[model samples]
Target: MPQIDPNFVFPVLIGDIGGTNARFAILVDSYAEPKEFPVLLTQDFDTIEDAIQSVVLDHTSILPRSAVIAVAGPVEGDEIPLTNCKWVVRPREMMERFNLSDITVLNDFEAQALAVVSLDDKHLENIGGEAAHPNGKRVVLGPGTGLGVAGLIRSRQTWVPVPGEGGHVDFGPRSQRDCQIFPFIEKIDGRISAEQLLCGRGLQHIYQAVCLADGITPCLNSPAEITDAALDKSNPQAVETLELFVIYLGRFAGDLALFFMAQGGVYLSGGIPQRIIPALRNGSFRAAFEDKAPHQHILKSIPVHVIVHPLAAIAGLSAYARTPARFDIHTDGRRWR
Candidate 1:
């Protein structure tokens, strides 16, 4: 276990790097909140080090002695490659390039999970269910460039984040409409993983599948167009696509809650959920979440919330950097202090 240095310097760098965007922030002091810097497009930079330098050196005057980067992919070995991005993050190279004394890389969802306890009413929009259990397990997930999942367990007073590639699990159809749509999805991708029909690309695929099922020519070109059409009730295919998306999201959340026994709550984060708040508040999401028989009662008791904080992962990474011992990070069959 690594010990927290009593003389450790202030002003740590924190980042939440996804496939599309890389968000950076700095924690100047223990009492001060993280100050966010302008977001950088991942494609603009060829390397993660370049992205970090562009943000840290160009904008801020503060020189950080350490950093904690939350990446939207599995963090393993020495090279952590993002699932949906072209850049590969090599920790040792970054440390040398940035002149950092210490650095930690975490799965994006692991950082999101760490932020669960830090979230308050202002950062959350409740969807359904009773109050969260005081000490029950909490599950955090969302769809952005891809789907991410993690669980938060309360050990003593600290929270332990359990990150996994839960998004890649086989997607199971739950409704008559789902059964019909699966064929269309399988035709395109050969196999239907949960992420295949739940993330940004997944939304587009769902729109295509809906159009095919209705014998209509596919017209929507992007996820944004589909969402816009659905929100305005302009296209029946887009509307149906959003409906199925909400239902599938609910089912997936419920399944994860069951798997983690998340009585604390199920939190929806990422770029997609905040945009589709109205669809989530509708009855379809809750109805599908509680549809599982014999376990419906348990599901009903689990609270569902949408994380509205834009820089939540940065806050999480900041917390972990300040006190690494407070978190239980599962990586390479080891736990860091």
Candidate 2:
């Protein structure tokens, strides 16, 4: 069992590091809410340590005694390499450089999974399905710089987060449109993975694929631009691209639900879901989610919710930092506390 230090000092450093931005916070105490710092763009700093120093250390007078960082990558060995960013973080190096007693690093989605159960109705916008089952298993996933997937299981009184590289799994096309788009995606990369069509870059790729299918010139340069065009109904190709993106997202989410038997709920997080809330609420997403034959009824019963909280990962890291025993995380051989 993991032990929590009752006498741990105040001002514990907490961070949620993603490909696009790095969010930092300082926890004064276990009971008090964390004081969040300004979000720092990941590209501004050459290294993860530099980003931390510039954002957290340069701004605050309170030096943290301990740190808990949620990184968007696989946390395996001492070195945690971000999947989307070039910065490779070394926890022990960070501890020594920052003069911290201990540091715990977690997969970004793992932190999100921990935050799922704690989220209230205010932090969520329901997308589909019936009421969420009270104690059933839950799955949390979303598209950002890359796709992130994690499972939450209620083990007795504690919630355990099961983290994996589910984003890199094979992409299965369910519809005729998906079948047509797969070849274009396959041309870019030999095998079609979930991340290739579900991330920020994935959105752009989808837009390009739509243009290719129509034999038209691809005009949009970025995912934001594509979404803008789609929302404004300025470009038919962009609109179709977004529609396909939603269907793929729904199908992929359903696959995850089936794999995890996520009866509690399917929670969507990250940048894409929140930005495209209108598209998600158009009934197409839910319809695609429940299109599976044998388990259509099962999928319909599982509620879908989009996390609206901006700093959910920070809340989760704080929860773990305060009460380590409440979460059953398999750290491999790593000692978090």
Candidate 3:
């Protein structure tokens, strides 16, 4: 059960646990900077606690009194199973193993949204539009192990991070070319979801779909190969796949901008955006994003930035640890004591 009063004790341990990597940091005090540890691969550890014990506790004598974990899964019940990884976030077990007073869990994108709130200009590259509106609503979405989506809304002085399975929303072909190729794209649970065609595997899916649509033999098996071939324009099929990807991404971002009425801006996180900066900036992305018939004017003012921060989620956890009052995370049944 959650503690009656969720008071975050100092010397807190904060982590951004993803499907592939788990990053941790320690906030010793409000004034001191976060002491970040080495990144750990999820498959290398048997459990989330084991990785923490090996990389963090084993190396440093600085024990934490509390922990705030942002995982790539829904934060529910005592056991929070990661969507893509084998490791599970067991708050009860973590509390007992670390001898911590409290543990607060959050969705991975929720952490990303918090980073959106605290991030500055240097960590972002402008893809389109003007400067962000001060304290306005913002969204952060990206494709990595999967497509992650989250939004930030300001309420009084604190910012609220809204996290959900927005990535799984239905995405259909809008153009004639899309209709010709989208049928070959893979489907999850029978229907095509945004993540189905926008993730690392999604890149492969797109390449394969293009190959099948054009009656060509599929060669690229990995996302890296497809992306590299696309970037270099060494393969015509790969090039077309990348162009389609950019269009799909823009359409989704635009849709979210209109849905959330996000005036602050849309931040593209994850590894994909950083890799395809050139493709994203070639004007096709912005054009597809602004193609909404009646909503072009609204999207014009809404900016889009790609987050270039390598350790954004860890920084977000650090921010929450340092100033928990600034973000409304709503740790109701999530915090275990």
Give the per-residue lDDT of model 2 (tens digit) for 173-290: 6668777766666443567888999999999888887778768999899999999999899999989988989988999899999999999999999889999999999988998899
Cα lDDT of all candidates, in order?
0.86, 0.87, 0.90
Instruction: Tell me which of candidates 1 and 2 scores higher on lDDT.
Output: 2
Q: Between the candidate structures 2 and 3, which one is better when assessed by lDDT?
A: 3
Q: Where does model 1 exceed 4 Å of error?
A: 1-8, 187-190, 330-337
Weakest 10 consecutive residues, lDDT, candidate 3?
1-10
Q: Give the TM-score of candidate 2.
A: 0.95
Q: Rank the candidates by lDDT, best first.
A: 3, 2, 1
Tens-place lDDT digits, model 1, residues 249-315: 9999999999999999999998799999999998999998988889999999999999999888987
Clashing pairs in 3: none
Per-residue CA lDDT of model 3 for 20-120, tens digit only, reads: 88999988987787889998899999998889999999988899999988999888898889999998788988899899988899999999999987777
User: What TM-score do all the candidates reach, one by one?
Assistant: 0.94, 0.95, 0.97
How good is model 1 by TM-score? Answer: 0.94
Better candidate by lDDT, 1 or 3: 3
Query: Which runs in model 3 stand beyond 4 Å of their true positions?
Result: 1-7
